[model samples]
Target chain A: MKPILPFLLFALLLGFSCSRQVQRIETDTTIDLSGRWNDTDARLTAAELVTEIMGRPWLERHVSKTGKEPVVIVGMVENKSHEHIEAEVFTKELEKAFIQSGRVRLVQGGEKREQIRRERADQQNNASQSTMKQWGLEMGADYMLQGSINSIMDAYNRKKVIYYQIDMILTDMETNEVVWIGDKKIKKFVKN
Target chain B: MKSYLFTLVFALVFCGFAMAQSSDQNPRAQQAYEAYAEKADNSHAASLGATVDKTYEAHDPILIKEQRREDRREFRRQLRLERARRPIIQNNPFGYYPYW
Candidate 1:
């Protein structure tokens, strides 16, 4: 009877876990289930970097030289970290921060740029002449923002220390000059 | 003849002032807005503006390391300046643990 009771309790717990209980939470909630990279890290890093990037002399220099708010486009952000991190999520956050600051102009790039071209092509065929979007009239991005995510892990016994470094750079599209460089470091200690 | 010369000088001064005012008014914002309104043709677009390239290229690590090292140095200097912004307290007869 005792053995049977233990088995029944185990089965009940397994069933309860199998039946997922999901509760809606606020978007701003910092829920770190694992010590791995998360949305909060991406968001906070982006927000902090935006302030630094905007405050840097490159922004003022660009304005002074060009007499315009430099048009920036989010480029490739390669994830070279230990875990599988979605680079798009971080890139989107960076783009969002730039746009929200209202300091620099933002433009679409990558797959989205292709999608826009496809739409323009379609419009040429279907839409009226007046309403159809023109070709080759797109805003040329002045600066390309690219970076890499790298990590160094130190593990001893059952404890692990993970350090992630996210480096972001802004380069002149025409000159290939790295105008601005910013980095964010996140270190977490996990013990088992 | 004197009145005519005076009128010419006045015209030149007014013209210079107008030019300075026009230059002060940055046209960048208006130019971008007008680009939309004008709907510029793509006929010569191929000859204009640099294209965004290098879909994926690694950054120079050495240069970045140097930049980071410089940044750390700058940050330390900033911290020192910030600390100095507040006057340091010295040991007094009425206070303890104030020596620095």
Candidate 2:
């Protein structure tokens, strides 16, 4: 029993030493473990897409016609990847890029818009008359941005390749015309 | 005793190989990374002025929160700098001398 106790202690120490260790890293640093959809992919996609979308001629045309920055509302971004990818991660980054560009104007949409409307409705009855927000005065969105993410995976034994494509489209709300289309493709290979 | 030593050496060698393999990147992945870096650099160069000069009309709550967090971090960093710059005082048992 005494001999076994020493061996057990050593094994326990080894196990503890081998335990996983985590270290905080810079957010922009690209660290791919499984080579799947990750934060780096989302960030790069958002940056590239914003750069491409903003450089396009459609924005200038819209501004020339309207004499004002185009107001945009973010719509759904569907994820059709092989893995369970949170589509909102990429969408939120894209939304941030659009808002920061100063060239485009973004309006509240989805549940937030509903919440604002509810607040306005509540204010009508319970709030003072001078400061109450009036209904129908909200700035309507001129264009709606929507997109989809798709991925293709090819694996053979210990070797694997993943290809992800993000496609975004902006459409005119009034005319139902597709104003702009942008896409970014990322491919990664892994071998175990 | 010989068998135990052999097992220990085998385990150590295996761990070494595992560590080496984990850090090894496939040639294709390396190529892809190079291409991605190049494209990113080109895109950044092309959109430099536009991105820098652009202005937004509305503020997203998330962005505002991030800005506030950054402000707090900057304030903490300034406090740390001030503390670091402060001179340390040593007490002399004999007297409160400036040299001490």
Candidate 3:
């Protein structure tokens, strides 16, 4: 019993010493703990792709031909990566870049657009005649941007390489013409 | 004791020979070595200079106007590609839902 008591004391000390630790880090910091898809990859890919897309000649041509900024709506960004990745995370980043550039106009689409329409319908009855929002006044999007994320992974024993590719394309809604195609490819070599 | 002394002497002789072989004696040889080192430094500088920094100047009115016109035409050509791909969204409320 005396020996067991000393062993228990040692175990408790070891347990306390081995306790997990956590620390807060900056949101934009590049941290690759498990060598998988992470915030850094999403941010870098979105930023680079958006920069390229905005800098392309298509934007200038659109503005010159139409004499106005092109109205764009984000359609979909499908995640087909080897690992589970949230496409929305990067899609929202792309949207943010477009809005921040002040060169493109964005319109609400999908469920959010429907919600706005529903509220406008409710306003038709509840709101005052002057203040009530009119129906059929929604701005139509002239272009749609969509993309897909794909990946290739190769592993040999303790060494592995992961390659991720994100492809985005902007299309003219009226002509169904693809205006621009931009891609971001990230490759990582991990060894254990 | 004899073997230890012999080993020490042998080691000292070998190290002395290595050091003598490494030292440059002739003034011409030393000059040649310095010249080679300078050449290598110059080569490295030239390699660095090969990486030209691209700068755009909008001061030239004619060049800028021509460049802008070319850019617009190129953009129209790129956007006029055949309609092979379609927009991912149809009537779906949510644009794209990830399958976990």
Clashes of each: 0, 2, 0
Worst 10 residues of 3 chain B by lDDT: B48-57
Give the alpha carbon lDDT tens digit for every residue of A9-106 in model 3.
Answer: 99999999999999998999998987888999989988888788889998999999989899998776666665677767777877787798899999
Order of the predicted models by lDDT, top scorer first = 3, 2, 1
> Positional deviation of B8 in candidate 1, in angstroms?
24
Which candidate number would show the highest DockQ if scored against the true structure?
Answer: 1
Chain B TM-score per candidate, please. 0.34, 0.33, 0.31
Docking class of 3: incorrect
- Cα miss at A129, model 1 (Å)? 1.2
lDDT of 1 at A92: 67
True contacts kept of 2: 0.00
List DockQ for all candidates.
Answer: 0.02, 0.01, 0.01
True contacts kept of 3: 0.00
Off by over 4 Å in 1: A1-19, B1-100
Residues B3-36, candidate 2: write the lDDT tens digits. Answer: 9999999999999999897666565987887898
lDDT of 1 by residue, A1-192 (tens): 678998999999999989978899987789877667788887778777877787899988998998999999876666676577665666666677778888899987665666688889999999998999988788999998888778887766556677888888999997799999998888888776
